[model samples]
Target: MEFHHLGVATADASGLAALFAELFDAPVAHEEEFDGMTVLFLELEPGYFELLEPHEGGAISRYLENHGPGIHHVALQTDDIEGALETARGAGVELIDDEPRPGAWGHEVAFLHPKSTGGVLVEFVSH
Candidate 1:
């Protein structure tokens, strides 16, 4: 598996992404709107950071409402997401999405329940 990206839930993605852009002096690799959210992918040396701002109501917005802006999840790249999910299930880890779903950068993604991942939301992805 490879480190993919850190997805951060924030109220102001444009502002926060801009801050990160200045801090790293790196260009935003991609920006898109989907499922009531605006997302920015800021590329780093090895991976990227995904800034999520829910324009309407979605997971990120709900996260902000409940936890108030924080690291939402860490995405790890895998060769096969479904295989990875099955591996996790075999290990007795609960899953938020039992099946892979469409994700940022056109990858297949699944979330392992935070309860099973040391209280950090862990996402498995395969592009």
Candidate 2:
């Protein structure tokens, strides 16, 4: 499982992006809008850093308001998302999305909630 991306929940998207730019000397690679989320993807050596801010009012915004900026989830790249999700389910992980869904950047992804992974959200994606 290759490290794909780290999802960061931030109240201020531009502020966090600026900080990353200053620290890593890397600019935002791309920006994508999906459903109710606005995601900023930043390239980091072998993987990526994703800054997620709620577009209007949604789960991410609520999470940020309640918990401040923090790591939201870790995404792993896989060849088969369905196989991974099935494996997770077999192991009794609490999946947020029981089925894989279309994700950002034309990938299929599924999320296992934090409750099932020691309070760490895990996402498996098939490119």
Candidate 3:
């Protein structure tokens, strides 16, 4: 697997994207809105950082309310998402989704629960 990106929950994605631009000298790589959230993707040396700003209500909103703006999850890329999910299950890791689903940039993804991962959410993706 390869590093994909780190997901960050924020109150203002665009504003944070701007800050990241100045900090990294990198422009936004991608932008999208879904599931009551706005996402801004920024390129980094290895992968990217995704800033998630919540709208009315959703996971991001709840995350912010409970933990404030901060890192949400880390995503790793694989060649086979199904195989990765099975490996996680075999290892007795709790999963948010038992099966892979479509994720950003049309990649297949599955999330591992934070409870079993040192309180850090982890996602595996395959293009």
Candidate 4:
């Protein structure tokens, strides 16, 4: 697996994207409205920064309520998502997603529970 992107929960994705563009020389690579949120992927050298702005009450909204705007999860790109999930399961990592599901950017994604992943949410994505 390789680093894919860092998911950030924000109330203003456009504002943050603009700021990151100027500060980090990152450009918006992709943008989409998915799962009730505005998702923007900013291009960086190695990977990307995925900005998530919730449109209504949902996981991101609830997350922002609990823990202001900040890093949410880290994603890793894999060739085989199912294999990765099985590896995680074999290691006893609790799965937040027992199976892959549709994610932003038309990728198959699954999440591992943060509690079992050193308190950091980890996502496995297959393009």
Using lDDT as the measure, what is the rank order of every candidate, best first? 4, 1, 3, 2
TM-score per prediction, in order, is 0.95, 0.91, 0.94, 0.98
Top lDDT prediction, candidate number: 4
lDDT, candidates in the order shown: 0.88, 0.86, 0.87, 0.96
Between prediction 3 and prediction 4, the one with superior lDDT is: 4
Evaluated against the true structure, the overall lDDT of model 2 is 0.86
| Candidate 2, residue 34: how far the Cα is off, in Å | 1.8
| Reference-based lDDT, residue 41, model 2 | 85
Stretch of 10 with least lDDT, candidate 2? 26-35
Tell me the tens digit of each residue's lDDT in model 1 across 1-127: 7999999998888898889889987569899986788889988988889999888877787889899998999999998888999899999999999899998668888999999989989999886
Clashing pairs in 1: none
Model 3 Cα shift for residue 70 (angstroms): 1.0
Once fitted onto the true fold, the runs of candidate 2 whose alpha carbons sit more than 4 angstroms away are none
Inter-residue clash pairs, candidate 2: none
Q: Candidate 1: list runs displaced more than 4 Å.
A: none
lDDT of 3: 0.87
Residue 106 error, candidate 2, Å = 1.8
Off by over 4 Å in 3: none
Candidate 4 Cα errors over 4 Å, as ranges? none
